[model samples]
Each structure stands twice: as structure tokens, then as C-alpha cells.
Target: MKGRTTAWLRKKAKRGFRGYPIATVAFYGPTGDFATKVVASIFPDEGSDPAAMERWFTQDTDVRTDAEIGEQVIAFVRGHAALSIVVTDGIIGCPHEEGIDYPDGTSCPKCPNWAGRDRWTGERVH
Candidate 1:
């Protein structure tokens, strides 16, 4: 997988994504232990097939389909600041997991489908 990603990065370079895109995941367990951690995830993969992405669920930190996930995580960690509960967060890529051309099956990227359906729940992302 790493080798495949390296080759993919080279391809992205030609497309003008010269550097690695930033991606991070934060989570607050049901127990309320707030934490935030940065990750080098979400590479520029040319193929975004579900079969290929299914494997990524293990190696990559999956961001649940929630807007402002990063801000929520940060709030959980910092408790109270001047910002208060006005937490705000956004993924490095406003829209993630793009550029897969599939005919029979759905795409694996986390963003909304081209038709505006939720990739996970099949609901409208908008």
C-alpha cells in the first residue's frame, strides 16, 4: 500500500499537488475523554474504489460524516477558553476523497457523492 501511495504521490505531483495534503482526526469517546491528534492521512490516490478504501479503514483514521469534527475534538481537549463552545473545525480538504471513476459501484471517498448523497448513510450531505 505504501509503495502504491508513493507512486500515486508522484502522479499527483504532475497534477500540481506538490506536497502532502494535511489530514487529522479527533475523537471524544462516550466516556468523554477528549483528545485530538494530527495524522498524515488522506493521500492523493488516483483510484478511490470502495474495495481499496475498505482496507484503508484499518490503516487510516476514518472521519465520521460530521461537519466540524476537528473543532469538536479541540473543544473536548481544551475545555474552556475565550472561544467557549463556539468550536469550529474543518478538514484540510473541504471536500475529501475525490477522483474515482466507477460505473457499477459507489465511490469510497468521505465527501458527498457527485449526486449529493451521503457516502455512508445515503442521506443528503448538504
Candidate 2:
């Protein structure tokens, strides 16, 4: 049940671009090893930005393995009647938002592990 929801979402994403109303899913955390937050957005069409977005957070559990959170994510996508789903394969970055959570040019004080590292690859950056 833990991995099942994640698998289902991934399966939907693997179906490729079916049509309009695409759902995008991304995970974030303090470190690349554990996802503490998940953000899901719905794009109505190719040229349009996301019309709807939702975020879930967990401090003690990984959002990837949280059954309830996964269910909510599935429901959100379905509720939007999304024809396509795109999910990130790994944690992309910190859960905090730049400019909103911290200054734009400064590293997130709450997520030092992600500082000076590539968000997608989690590799140290020069």
C-alpha cells in the first residue's frame, strides 16, 4: 500500500501525452533521500500555466510513502479530469519556496542539505 499509490501515479505518467489538462507532480525535501513535501499542479493546456495546484507536507514521514497523501494526490488529479500525468522520478529540491520562504539569492536555512547541490541530480554544484 505504501508503494502502490506511487506506482499507480507513475503508471499514469508513463502513458505519455494523451491530451489537454495535464497533471504535474514533484517531490521536495530537506535532503534528496526523503521526500517531505509533494506538489501537484494541473495545466489546462499546452500554452497555459497551471490552473490549479496543491501541496502536501509531512515532517515525520516521507510523503512518497504516505498512503493518505498519495490518495489525495490521485483524487486531485482525477478531480481535475487530467488527461496526462507527469511525475518527477526523484526529489527535486527543498520544500521551501524561494522569495517566499527565504530571500531569493540565499540558501534555505531549513534545508541545508540541498544547498549548493543540483536539485534534479542531488550532486554538489561548483
Candidate 3:
């Protein structure tokens, strides 16, 4: 497989192409326990454009140190067939940051620090 360029991936991510099927990817341990998860959107391949698809895969897929773990994710996705199209790749997920509320899990409104606006921007937190 050819190497994935971080610069290309970053560019796609900036454009907001998350993960395939537009869902969260939760990785699991060998014992079938939860390990970590990414909330990236996957970008589908462009017709007759293998290069575009390859770029998307390089951007969306996580570069796991453990080959086994990586394979497991592929198997899981294939088994579930949770794909909208032939998923190549794109942005994997956003990095977890403090004071930033992701759309998943707890909503910003319910958070204790929620003051009807974003703490940093003073805009509506929602």
C-alpha cells in the first residue's frame, strides 16, 4: 500500500469529510472490550478516480500500531456492512479537547459549565 500523506488528509478534514457512513468508530481490544473511539466522517470514492479514493482512505483510517487491531476494525465494518459506498478513507476523527463538547454523549446545554453560550467564543454553545 502506498503511504498516506498527512497534508492531504488535513486538507480533506478541514473540508469536513468525516468518516464513512458518518458515524463514530469505536475500537475494541483483543478481549472484545472497548479501547478508544474516533468520530471521523468517511468520504466515498470518486467514480473512476482511484487516486481520490486512496487519498480518502489514507485520511479517514486510523494508523494503528497494532496490525491486529486494525484488521479487527476492518472486519467489523465489513461484517456490519455499515458503508454508504466503497469507503476509501478521509478524516478519522477529531481529537478530544477540553471544553469542547462533541455532538455525541452529553449535550452542551446539560453540561454544568453551560452558560447558554460557548465559554471561548461567547456564541451559542448549541
Error (Å) of candidate 2 at residue 79 is 0.2
- What lDDT does each candidate get? 0.29, 0.92, 0.33
CA error at residue 15 for candidate 2, angstroms: 0.8
As a whole number from 0 to 100, the lDDT of residue 76 in candidate 1 is 30
lDDT of 1 by residue, 1-126 (tens): 124432332343345433322122322111112112222223233343211111112213333322244344333323321111111132222132234433335433432333454333435665
Instruction: Please report how far candidate 3 places residue 63 from its true position, in Å.
Output: 3.5
Q: Is candidate 1 or candidate 3 better by lDDT?
A: 3
Candidate that beats the other on lDDT, 1 or 2, i.e. the better one: 2
Better of 2 and 3 by TM-score: 2
Regions of candidate 2 where Cα sits further than 4 Å from its true position: none
Candidate 3 local lDDT, 1-126, one digit each (tens): 112333332333355543444322432111112223322233334332221111112223344333444454444444443343232332222233335644555533433333344433435656
- Candidate 2 TM-score versus the reference: 0.96
Clashing residue pairs in candidate 2 (N, C-alpha, C atoms within 3 angstroms)? none
- How many Å off is the CA of 1 in candidate 3? 10
Give candidate 3's total backbone clashes.
13
- TM-score-better candidate, 1 vs 2: 2
Which clashing pairs does model 1 show?
none
**lDDT tens per residue, model 2, 1-126:** 158888889899999999989999999989888899999999999889899999999999989989999999999999999999999988999999999999999999999998899998889995
